[model samples]
Target chain A: MGQYKITLSGEAQTAIVRHGEQAFPFECCGFLYGHENDGRFVTEAMPVANNKKGDRRKQFEISPPDYMKAEKYALGNGLQLLGAYHSHPNHPAIASAHDLALAMPYFSYVIVSVKNGKAADIKSWRLKETIEKKFAEEKVAVKHMAMFSD
Target chain B: MAKIIIPTPLRKFTANTATFETSGSNIKEAIQELTGAYNGLTRHLLDNDFNIRSFIKIYLGEDDINSLQKEDTTIANDSVISIVPIIAGGC
Candidate 1:
């Protein structure tokens, strides 16, 4: 229902591919590392296991160690947290009900859905609020970003 | 032939495929067959006792597997079984 021009740099593409591979059958959650000045964002896949104690609903928790490392990497590169990424397993690359509820105000959400072992599809979304405001202000523009496979 | 829907995380264990035609006559047999095929997926779906882990839920044709027959639930040839991992996220 929301529209925006989402660009993915080569690095972001690879990061997604790697994350897709690592979190097979479950959701892979990680952060997008980028800075305003860099003109390009690089995705670093952080390994986070699902913390669903007893429920089979899709859940994700960035491991503390991985989180710290991502934070460190972002800080060292003067990049900001560009967005978050996760996988959809067999479902389509659409945001689930849980996804919309957990989304913050201004961040990109990348969903990678795998069908039959292959990365079937990928898509991006800005929070609804951001999408609405972009439409209102006519600034529906987003910078390019890439994912690293490693 | 039961339609087994694979979750995204477990795809790696399932040869990176999503849904597959499983040849198990029932739900338990089907899952067992799948686990037998993908050694790494057994741990994520079943615990040490080989029981369905509390963290995973199975749905058989829109019905919750727990209320029906749990893992022993039978699978119709046309049934669609989904294994979706309940995901909990931290800010």
Candidate 2:
């Protein structure tokens, strides 16, 4: 197991929570960005609705057209995608079995789990095979199963 | 017996079951078995050469298959595999 940290601004957190609530019965997803060397992630894009399943777990996906837009934006600004964020409504704010399988090595996965029908918990994860890793939440640190990148 | 957890997006391919258990020695064999049973999903999860699709992500426990052993990653009876597709959108 490895550790990862996901650092994002307060405004980002508020937007993520609000988007999660808006997509109550399905999952919502979006992107987080910050300076390459900086620690704070700023929520940039708007949240998208999951057209796949109507489940409460928001699954964020960029469409082809949107991907082109995001790519242009990143190229123009020299900012790469830092990571992704989603919500697990009515479930624990941990990586689901589906999450671990599809994880990218360099990106962070942020999950906000709603409790009692409310967004009550937030967590982050980074997948590592056997190597030790560190994730930044508010600051950088290394420990057991800690998450990095937001 | 390794169990595969299907993501919500792919549930339509699996008849809406969240998890499936099969006997296989490694991740590749397990996924092959799954796609065989699921029909058209093979194209969605893998390319003609069996590499994972760019839009999809696969993980075993806390370790991503790309960082671990790819399709050759061993699957034990107790292991759980997760499949999550990348989502893109803004609020």
Best by DockQ: 2
DockQ metric, candidate 2: 0.08
Task: List where candidate 2 sits over 4 angstroms from the true fold.
Answer: A38-40, A43-45, A53-64, A129-150, B1-85, B88-91
Best-fitting candidate, scored by lDDT: 2
A-chain TM-score in candidate 1?
0.69
TM-score of 1: 0.48
Winning model by TM-score: 2
Per-candidate TM equals 0.48, 0.52
How far does residue A116 in candidate 1 sit from its true spot (Å)?
2.2
The CAPRI class of candidate 1 is incorrect
Give the lDDT of residue A9 in candidate 2.
62
* Candidate 1 residue lDDT tens string, A1-150: 444344555666667767775667666777776544434343343445554454322556443334444545655776665566777777787766666554443456777776655677777655544323231111122235323222
